[model samples]
Target: MNAKKLQKKIFPLPKQVEVKDGALKLDKVALKITADVHTAKQAAAVLEKKLAALGIGVCDCAKTTITLALGEAPAQVQFAEQGYRIAVTADGVELTGFGAQGVYYAAVSFVQMLDREIPCCEILDWPDMDFRGHVIESRLGSDLMEKEDWFAMID
Candidate 1:
């Protein structure tokens, strides 16, 4: 997959992207989370579920591993509160986030890029605005919103 093509496929487009030759083919993968980072664990679990839906299994050991961690952005780049970097290569995929919210976003982006294979690339992204919200007006509907409706809206 071409980097340009992949970029177009991703919603809200990443701030920075670089692609190299070849792609990483995913079969079974090992998911590793940074110790002490509860958000990383949660992000890994979310990714695992998405992969399972694609018929890819995750386990304790594998040639290909996806790592989730909370860390600083590369020196040249200053990440916002919810910024993240995703690097995919023949070696493996590394998803690093600046915060808990960043970790969740990183997992979401990685999941979006999944297919039979992922293009070898690096993506740096963050929301333009620190605050994002949605307001649902109950007045428009005759019936009260169910719990599932709220969850669905959030998703």
Candidate 2:
């Protein structure tokens, strides 16, 4: 595992053989991403597919639409971003914003973390850098780059 990169971190996800939600019994596994549009929807879709592959039912995502922020490199990372956050949760997890990406990576990481028949664990993590950028700050607005004007240039 790469110590500096988050994907290296491994943790276990609880295997709930039975789940009872209030008066209803649901073997269904629940999840929600409290984040903005594009990323949130994409993340929710990806998670649902992965869970189905594992034979686990995906519950539901919190909401559909997300509001764009003022100006914080307001775009989703295509190949995923590297950070210091990714943790296991009790039920599942509630991840939001750029921080939520970390959770997505962690869920995948948790799958790899399990030993033979091992189950039930939790983790708490967060990234140090708040801003995630795909382009170099210097090349942002120039004719060479031609990126959006709202993009921020961190010094």
Q: Give the TM-scores of the predictions, in the order they appear.
A: 0.80, 0.38
Task: Report the error of model 1 at residue 6, Å.
Answer: 0.8
What is candidate 2's local distance difference test score? 0.37
| Runs off by more than 4 Å, candidate 2 | 1-26, 60-84, 96-155
Candidate 2 on 34-95: residue-level lDDT in tens?
44445556556665665566665554452221121111222333322422123223333333
Q: Which candidate should be chosen as best, given lDDT against the real structure?
A: 1
Task: Report the C-alpha lDDT of model 1 over 1-155, residue by residue, as the tens digit.
Answer: 67788888777788888998878988889988883567777887789888989998788778898988877866555445588989999878998888888888888888888876888999999887778565775536588788887888779
| Deviating ranges (above 4 Å) for candidate 1 | 74-79, 135-155
Q: List the residue pairs that clash in candidate 2.
A: 14-120, 88-123
